[model samples]
Target: MAGNSDPLTPRAKIAVTAGKAVAAASRAAGRGSGSVIGGRVALKLDPDLLARLAQNLDVVLVSATNGKTTTTRLIAEALRAAGPVVSNALGANMPAGITSALAGSSDARYGVIEVDEKYLAGVARDTAPKCIALLNLSRDQLDRAAETRMLAEAWREGLAGSKAVIIANADDPLVVWAASSSPNVVWVAAGQMWKDDAWSCPSCGGVMQRPGDDWFCGECGFRRPTPSWALSGDHVLDPHGSAWPIHLQLPGRANKANAASSAAVAAVFGVPPQVALERMYQVQAVAGRYDVVQFQQRDLRLLLAKNPAGWLETFSLIDPPPTPVILSVNARGADGTDTSWLWDVDYTRLTGHPICVIGDRKLDLAVRLEVANQHFQVCENLDQAVQLCPPGRIEVIANYTAFQDLRRRVGN
Candidate 1:
């Protein structure tokens, strides 16, 4: 029950040592994936390691169906003013990754963590974070995450038992309902573009109606929460109506929203709004999410598109016609074996572009593209695919595993 700042039990010490050894070996063997196996070993030995490592730390936990990683990165950067912050920048967000992050930086005073949505409750219980940032909820990892409404209900149940302040997206009805029961909440109108999974109210099960920028349920009176922190155009508005212009190198309107959400969290932790916004400008790439790198003697910009919502947001940032884009997809376990979500995305958006589809799921993507009337070709090899694209600055968009593969291949 000791806090993370407290001295670890002798057994926990041994566990940490052993875990680090395993992590080192994994790295030596070219199989290291952040703290994946190492943290698992540590937790297996001390079962209560996360709680122990989280002791005495000002922890901020972030969870969402999308943007958790980038948001976490932005929050972590903002927390730097506090000195020596612990965070799992490696993109491993389950219990193991969190455990590794806390265990390695047991002396740190602050922690910023990205948590998988399905495991948020347990992680929250273990870390007893000072604040929990809830981003928009949508259909994702259908095989593992089940239903979005159920996840929202679970989040509602979990926050009801915690004292952590909830910083949530007010535009997401699901997020609003999830944090409704929490006594202390900071709402931000960070925007939500995908509504396919939120037609019915989570609380009343009644069809929700959207008029203007807000939604209300006629049957049960459920509605979008009034936002105290709002993102309007290129500015973030405070509760008092003071606006801070946000200029981020990260592309897309979603990144601006992510900055607004992170700024809200920073404010809760006593970080000045201006200071938080300034810190966010320092982040150019988050685990290869929006970094441009060289591959096959061509400049390729990497964009990670995992689901329908993700694809929709990422596609919007691509430059208009005459820009060639390479689409890569894989049905690996990390990418969620269900490639059916391919049909859910509005591929018609790529109608005029010359699309090069490649990956384990290239055939599936090709079929989808063909139906969408997109101009396309299938190239199994990424290098060859790059060669096929038009000369300057190629845009590469990929699903989970394919994106990781590209990052590894390009040395990002």
Candidate 2:
């Protein structure tokens, strides 16, 4: 009784059974329709079960500050294009989510799972993936996660024992430092051919030499080596262009980074980089991250701004004349408990009076935007936002939940 009553004893299979039982109760209670939250509760029922169960299949672990879902999705797509590959296609990045995804797979030679940074260590212990892709780290969810440096350090320590081939994003200092720990690391970054906005050392707090596509820390002189898989383009780069010219369907220079990251992993697994790029371009948007739609006579392009960094990236994609725009903030606790970071983003750049009112914590967003006295059609929810969308090239930039809400409202 002293040693055996542990919660995670019987492992993930036991967790699965317990989860199903709890799910039945949740369905009875009319709770969430998602799998991760409750399934996570169930996953704790079995600790070692996942390791044992995962032994039969080769796995790929993909984690990033922003692009994990899109990159992993593209990686899975390329793998599928080549042959059969299984993954958590629904953007479940935690262990419980992993369990929920694994529940659906029948026969998969390769398992691609996007992992959450905080939980990666525990998950990695159980699921020693055949190849692990450590994407770049950034500041996000300061309330929940430590700084980017802390996450990178933790991840490096967590993945030590696994013999899986390591795929690292070489451009970011945090990732570069983590890659140093693994001797078998296969470094991947958008070749020194894309764009460089960062010039600060993540460590030592010094300026960096933006020499070409690569970077050099001036104070410490910690230089990131040229990545193995790289994008090929002058001003025009395929985000997935390590397999350049092959990926035509996927557009945008930022997308080239996404595609390149996926191509890197696919290449390590013997899938030609070009083939991966071709498969990636076949499907463009990863859910809400810049999905375009034809609305009435105008183009409603949905760009998801999860944080300040994402908003900055979205601004890079915006080159057209600064027209009226609507930025939606989700107030739902489910989206995230905090809505304060709206101020962190440089929303002031789109200087022209934004048709921005209030949303989500409607008062909060409107109050912030109102500092600039931007026009706002304050709505109770997304239903009202869809109604307020003006005609002609409507750019619908939103947070996580609002993106789906808007899509459903527009009937897209």
Candidate 3:
């Protein structure tokens, strides 16, 4: 087996050089970071480019419907305590992006990759990672991705006989079902706030009985496995019963849950819980998720909430009433063309806050807010939206593309 030094073959070297040139050209052309396009071109030139690039590195793959990017970033930071690490830091999570990241840093000792939920199986197969972190999964981009159960089954089937250690979330039934097939697994009791998708058992299609934090299928005897690591309020408890305080710059219980999972994955790489938590504390933002930008004398704390589950978490992190809140939604390809998912989120949570809506799908959000009996103004853009709020610190929560658009406008 290849170890720390896996030199690229001649063919791979040519492919990497070509990909780098394309990526540079793309950046020069202002077409955004060329990670995806570069990877696509490299893959077309060499079909086995990703597998080849991942040859001798200790790779870790993080996948979920939510928190995957943040978790991936956390895990990467934690792993850096041991050695040099290469990661798709920009949230480009597909095979091409992963390939581009790996090809760029062939000498890095570790690879921390964030895999798209639907593409986890393929990435796992290619990388043969040392550890795979399976975070919570819920409905997202329904038009482009399969249902959560189907994705779970694919995860189960794809990772059946893998040698890698699976670090999985025990609280999520879908994640539990997916990781159950793996023989070597480390379970983390990362809290699952969205229980709508996990009500039915993925195993027997039976009703899942939830007693406290434990969930089980009464019909088939499928149950939540005992976790080795657990999140207790603001602390993470390891198997040895050691409590490590999770003091992260990132807000929300969801991020604390991500920290717990990240600690478990870091432990797989021989990084202690305390050491991992300390390293993860420095991560203030993940690709502009919680970026606080200065705009029009008001500090705009940008929060990215792509789906219902994500929105629920974002609401918990926002400031209370009187602190204005901006809700933005865009139905672009990256944000999922179907804006119907907006209805799944409870807009009533913003009832007390002074609300303003802006984006391509602002009308959709306005109708939802109106139904929730929340008063909101539909603004043309972020400039107008920020102008509506009283100066100070304000919360700006936006879905995928809308958040990206805002970030671009703010020069993030």
Global CA lDDT computed for model 3: 0.91
**TM-score (all chains, Cα) for each model:** 0.97, 0.83, 0.98
List clashing residue pairs in candidate 1: 3-55, 4-53, 4-55
Residue-level lDDT tens digits of model 2 in 248-271: 444455567767777778877778
Badly placed stretches (over 4 Å) of model 1 are: 1-5
lDDT-better candidate, 1 vs 3: 3
Q: What is the lDDT for 292 in model 1?
A: 82
Better of 1 and 2 by lDDT: 1
Q: Cα deviation of 301 in candidate 2 (Å)?
A: 2.8
Error of 1 at 183 (Å): 1.3
Cα lDDT over the full model 2: 0.68
Report per-prediction Cα RMSD to one decimal: 1.6, 5.5, 1.0
Assess the local accuracy of residue 395 in candidate 1 as a C-alpha lDDT between 0 and 100: 85
Q: Highest TM-score, which number?
A: 3
lDDT tens per residue, model 3, 1-412: 3665556778878889899999999999999999999999999888898988887889999999999999999999999999999999999999999899998885688999999988989998888899999998898887887588999999999989888999999999999999988999999999888898999999999999999989999999999999999999999999999999999999989999999999999998899999999999889888988889898899999999999999998888788898999889999899888888888898888878999999999999899888999989999999998998888999999889898899999988
lDDT of 2 at 236: 19
